[model samples]
Target: MAERSTADLALTLTRASRTPLPVQVADGIRALIMSGALAPGDALPSTRFLAQRLSVSRGTIVAAFDQLISEGALLASQGRPTTVHPSLPAHLLQQVSAAAPDPTAASTRRPASPGASTAAAPGRPDPVPAPAPASAPAVDLRPGLPRTTRIGDAAWRSAWRRAAAAPEAETGGLTGLPDLRAGIAEHLRLMRGLPTDPAALLVTAGSRDGLELILHALAATRGTLSIGVETPGYPGLRRVPQVLGHRIVPLGVDGNGLRVDALPTGAAAPDAVIVTPSHQYPLGGSLSLDRRLALLEWARNEDALIIEDDFNSELRYTGAPLPPLSAIDPHGRTVLLGTFSRLLSPDLAVGFVRPTGAALLAELRDVREVLGVRVSATTQHAVAHLLADGTVRRHTRTERLRLGRRREALLAAMLDVPGVRVLPMHGGSDAVIRFDTAGSHRGRAGADPEARAVAACADAGITVGRLSAAWGAESQAAPVDPSPAAAVGGVGGAGIVLGLARPADGAFSAMLPRLASALATVHHTR
Candidate 1:
């Protein structure tokens, strides 16, 4: 095969597509390979050269190349140009001409730039367009997402380099890398005041992955267990158990977190229950100490396990951090599910599980190994380096301060809005606003005020989460059995969850007044 210039690649990209630039590039190359535009052993352009030609960052090109290499569609050897797999079948070569981009595409389509639509540049090929950027939200208040730009670029690059240098054969055994586990243990001891044995921690893809592992380990002995999750709780957590063919029991929450008194007893009692203790999702309330002890006792008495999701506990801006259920449990009935998705970037896809016992932990490890459920080796190492070098701690500190400021801005914006009750957020990046219709003045026909409120916010280019949507599907699908002692104590209502960690400091200032007006409109319409 002859070496072709970058311009001769004939790649067409649309900026308006939902697909990311890197994915688009990768898919384009893959299609070419499958259709045999690039033959067996044909070398591809260097990352730097391709990046320049595509007008994208080198990192984007690197990511695409890495994905292809992983799939065996391309071969990457040290100190040599990347080439197509030598074993590619001969029949695919026939489709090359049909798969190639139309040569007249440039002439037919208008250019994006003004005044360039009709100005013909003779024989000049159309420039490859980057993916269209989404319109910016005036204020982004969706919870569980962090502002990853706060992380230092230098530190991030250094961590990746350290990860790349890791031994390819070091699969981290069953749990994960030894250094990573040790780093996680030390982090728990110092930051969370929970001393953990390194061997007790099992690295997972995320908190959900950790939950799945535990369920897999328990399913053989427990046999299709019933699980209890909070009402108006995390939809993600609620879906997992049901997806695994287990029944869901809806437990409700008040201002002080989950109602432990409502937990079922006897044969109907759940085998396991998941709780977000330090900071409850959507509601932004902590579990009271007395209730915490009571809940732990229930777990012990019922012979049930508690899956404590200590999400956003480290971002506390007021008072002291409450001890997690795992930290206080004496009976080892609590398994802690912690993730970097809220604290760091969700892109990392890194989390860990602190199982109830060494035996159970071993079982979980065995299950993970059998199922081949391990986080990326590179990601594990990178996160380990960040944790070991105190980079994560430093980043958390910076992010906390940033989130605190945004919280204040959010409060300031909602001060004048009537009939909307704002809950106090001691920790976490989100706050709940309950909509009341007592003295609403501006009326709308045949529309729910809460729905109108959310729609208005969206129309104003301000994104906010709906609290009512988080209710488990089981609660909605099943009829209300009021006779049961374990029936949910609370009912779903209209409320909004505003995430404080999303907006940049500069963008926040301009968004506040607009948000206030939107809230006011909702109040008036109600």
Candidate 2:
């Protein structure tokens, strides 16, 4: 229930016909047309009607309408009536229209598909939309904890300045920066507790890009390769290896992270294992130390490569920093992949990969250059400076505290609303909450009661990424196991992952009552 905006108002005014009044008339019309006072194709009152209403001569109203028409902004006609031009002032139109529902619907014979290209949508403002229902639904608290607007302008400015000043050659076109490798190696040594040589470091566009490079490098390394991916684990995360023709085995993860003891041997044993040891996503949990030790042993015993995704390692709030699996891999069998997206921001487009040995590292670097997957030296420099200046590290400390408190508040408010259980947020910007039906762990079906809750929330103008979207949106997935003993899991009830980071200040504080009211009347239906 949004209040009418000022843009919805119309203008009622007249001017003397003897003198030119272009500015006043334009301003008046602008206010009306921009405001919804006059909609597209909506007829305007006759000149005489406006003139009499404004206590001015009909000639003046005619002159104003004539001027508006001449500017190609307003459509004016005597018998047919006049209205705002459908396409004038494109920017302002986008602002209003971005919020409008399928404008093309009226003209089409049938409704267009949601992803139809014929549908028109314009670019949004640079800053993330205000959290409290702006022109659109607010608070898209989904998992993956994407904080698109989290990166401060100061950091962007510095990064941009460095990027703008650096030579293009430094970005793997030949003029490489040895100092960057040195600094990066030192930083990883201290922060990630990984001992590595500077020459082994190769900057990558992202962790996924790093993964792609690994797949490309490993494509023919050993005879037929099969990799293991955690089930319901980051769907987009496993696509790189799969597209490269590697067979994917589904590995189950519980509270201990990926079950190392569950590694299938013989043909089932994967040549590589991808695990997010530091804050496992979806089902948020850290890898237990014993499991971490076993994972190292599994890789060693099976003679496999372990891909450790240390994404979002810096924002740990509940416990001390856990050592990455790579830190414990003494046999040099693990390839460590990480990104600044979680800690710094996603737009930075910077990630790094640490290989096990100098030979593997050198080979990957050569492949990286051949494949053109390097980040610019200036970006590396800017992040280095920010880290050196203590801004990024300092920001991490503050955001962790703020996010922890906000996460708690969001969880409390959601829990108070009947049928909603807020999943704890121990590691990232979002708090995943489940409602309506039961979790997928329960062997039941038709738990669509959760969908009723989602529908109620949608009616109140909340947009969320649901459990189904998260599961099926990605193109690649771990293979389904058909073991006779394997229990078929049910799809979790309508679950909503709410991001505490995106809400406008105090928006979460204000949304609880509206949410609770909606939930109060929600009930399951077939």
Candidate 3:
């Protein structure tokens, strides 16, 4: 087989189409392989090269490549060019060639349904099993998902019954139901040790919506602000700002969470900074006391707003939980974002934004009046009932114990996996594992052990989060730096972010050995 140039692939991508660019790329490559245009041993263009040729983000190309690799349609090893799987049966290639549809009649042909399968002609091997149906993973280890099944059915029913019995309000009002606000204020005071006025908190759809509300309010006063976000931070929160026309300045994090010293000054200073002080996402490092103080001081000096996402703070398994930045902000520069998504259920679509300063509170209120209330009166009342009756609190305590056991199990399972280190995570619903990509464990020039580990887990009916994905698209185009400071500016090290909230206790325990085995395989292969 001749070595193919980057242009030889000639992938056609339609931006206007509903399908994603990565899927289009993967489908094109798969078609080429099936048609024998790309032979069994034919090498493919590098992701970067192909991304450049296609005028798409390198991350897009990487996703396509990863999907192909996972489907066994391509072969990839550390430091070598990706190639068509050398073991693809010759008969399959011949069969596809013989059955090739005419380009002239392509538009006239009906597309096959996603689940439709072609029966094998004569005695040909079944078409590679169609890459496993896109069903829910038997063991889902993705982060941000909480175990909602643990909530007592009695408590759940009682909360809703109370909500249903309450006199209906014409509107949830601009800031949300007064009762819900009061309930949230009390909940925060008791649980998070942050005393807040119910009037100061504005109801939002969730944390992301809370963030959007903050940005909208802030942007109303200040035009497109430069917002500092932790590198390798939660993409869900990061995307909210980006989509709202704000510029994102990537900040680095370490063992103690967001690096205070790295905060840019002068012209580079951000107008606002978002931090997960209680428990950082993916990395699971809480901001240290010193760093928290420093961050508050920096915010005061720079006159920058601090957005604290206090999601999953109550789920900490070990040690006393730290006070939220909003609780300690003496200058009233912080706005706290909270959500029922992690503690209760995401289906509730309920959360709140509490600003420390009276001025900011007024600003958020004014913005809310203009935007109108999003949460329904019924939902707000339901959540208020939950909080008022201590159901939420008791449920939270139970979930903490349940999730703690899961976290401990995850730790115990990975303890003996060679070349893999599960980073210490005190709270939060997820844990991170860094791969030993250097020294003797360094596989090949370009091998990504973290990616391979994730692929292996996927092959075993387990789905896990990729650490590299947290760094955004640019990181995906190339190899991760794997340095402690690699994520200083959104670039990150190689690892997997394992969510501990999905599988049941027994199922999770059963999945751990499989997960550990996958890690071991990646290590040995490297």
Largest lDDT belongs to which candidate? 3
62-131 per-residue lDDT for model 3 (tens digits)? 9999998888788887897898777765554655633332222211111221221122111111111113
Once model 1 is optimally superposed onto the true structure by TM-score, how far is the C-alpha of residue 146 displaced, in angstroms?
Answer: 1.9
Q: lDDT per residue, candidate 2, 359-414, as tens digits?
A: 55655766766787466677777776665545655576667777777766666666
Q: What's the distance in Å from true for residue 66, model 3?
A: 61
True lDDT of residue 111, candidate 3: 20
Against the reference, the lDDT scores of all candidates come to 0.70, 0.58, 0.73
Candidate 1's residue-wise lDDT over 136-213, tens digit each?
445566656678485689998999999999999877977888988988886775456465778889998888898898
Instruction: Give the runs in model 2 whose Cα sits over 4 Å from its true position.
Output: 1-137, 167-169, 172-176, 436-447, 469-494, 516-526
RMSD of each: 24.6, 26.3, 28.0
Q: What is the lDDT of residue 434 in candidate 2?
A: 61
Model 3 lDDT-worst window of ten: 120-129
What are the TM-scores, per candidate, against the unseen true structure?
Answer: 0.71, 0.65, 0.71
